[model samples]
Target: MIDDKLKEKVQMLICGDLEAGEKAQVELLINESSELQSYYKSSKLSWDNLDNLAGIEPSKSFVTDFWKKADKEKNKGFRFFDFFKFNWKLAGSFAVFFVASAFFINNYFSDVNSGFTFSEDVEILNQLDNAITLNSDSSLEVYGPW
Candidate 1:
């Protein structure tokens, strides 16, 4: 991997900003290392291509137009939640979903039996009450202090 120091040195070498000694050292390093040699070659090719490209001359109003657009955007305050603006359609759909789900659940359960007849339910309640009374009486006798 190319290190930050080596990358900076390579950039400086490409830009012709390195001193004579630094340039010589970078050149030697590039010559000795295949990775550095490839990196330098690609960098030099890209820089040469960029230099040879013809520059586009912008219209005189380009700067003014750009600033005007920037100012307009700046004047319109930015909010992170603006992208998540609530839609009434979405809310209505969610409401419809919940209502439909509730209706389905109610209809499903309404058809199911209570699993116990009325008389059976009354008998079970009575048995439960008797069991609770017996338990309380036994606990009192067992835990009573002398």
Candidate 2:
């Protein structure tokens, strides 16, 4: 575990903010401890290297170009119902299908021999008689004469 006091003094020493007495104490500790010596060397090297990297000013058009590209990307993102622009064509096709189906159904049902009829065919009447029976009182009341 690192000693917090020593660490603080080392950081102040690296940043050139330690007083003369504190700097002497920290130097003594650093010289005695191999870990403190290594830490001090690395921290000072990093600090000196950072000083060599001077800040560069961006070009005049950089901000405007950045905003234009950002605006284009924002516009391209998360559009709802974008594919629905062609839905009118789908609606037209569905209308045509329903009209054709209704036309066929109407013509089919309108034919003379199309739907159910009370037939005079004995075999069909016998089949119907076998399948149905006037068993319940409610059925009799509905089907029977008053």
Candidate 3:
């Protein structure tokens, strides 16, 4: 039933080049010959099946490794100290010392201005005694009559 000539024509008609007269001839031939019609039906089904299945290509197990790599990259955490790469401890220590020195110097100057030293008060008392002795009425009064 599937002779070589009709097979060729079936291949062409499947590819969409057959004219209306050619299709009508094929249809008339199919109705009059029962075995030809069955063979043609099966071949037409095969052609239609191939046409429906075209332009679809599936890759093999494509997502497993891709997802694993993505998860690994996602779980990698950020390092907080990465940007300050050099002399981090030195910078921190310098900042601490600078702040302490500023605080100490400010307090030292403030204390110096607010408190009186013992030596300064004793010198002032001695100057007052000398001035009083120079203005006394008698030699015995050089030292005040205590």
- After TM-score superposition, the amount by which residue 143's alpha carbon in candidate 3 deviates from its true location, in angstroms, is 99
Which sequence of candidate numbers ranks them by TM-score, best first?
A: 2, 1, 3
- Report the lDDT tens digits of candidate 1 across residue range 1-146: 88989988999998899999989999999999999999988988887888888989999999999999999988889775453367767767877999999999887676556666668878999999999999988889877774
What is the Cα-based lDDT of residue 24 in candidate 1?
A: 98
**Which portions of model 2 show Cα errors greater than 4 Å?**
51-54, 61-146
Each model's lDDT comes to 0.87, 0.81, 0.77
- Residue 39 deviation, candidate 3, in Å? 1.2
Ranking by lDDT: 1, 2, 3
User: Which candidate number has the best lDDT?
Assistant: 1
Cα displacement (Å) at residue 123, model 3: 99
**Runs off by more than 4 Å, candidate 3:** 48-146
TM-score of each: 0.36, 0.36, 0.32
| Global lDDT of model 1 | 0.87
Report how far off residue 138 is in candidate 2 (Å): 72
Q: Write the per-residue lDDT of candidate 2 for residues 59-90, one digit (tens) a residue.
A: 99999999999999888977645544579887
Give me the runs in candidate 1 sitting further than 4 Å from their true place. Answer: 51-53, 56-146
Q: Model 3, 1-146: lDDT tens per residue?
A: 47899877766666677899997787787789888777777877876787776585666656887888889977876655553468789768877999999999998787688676667778989999988887665666768786
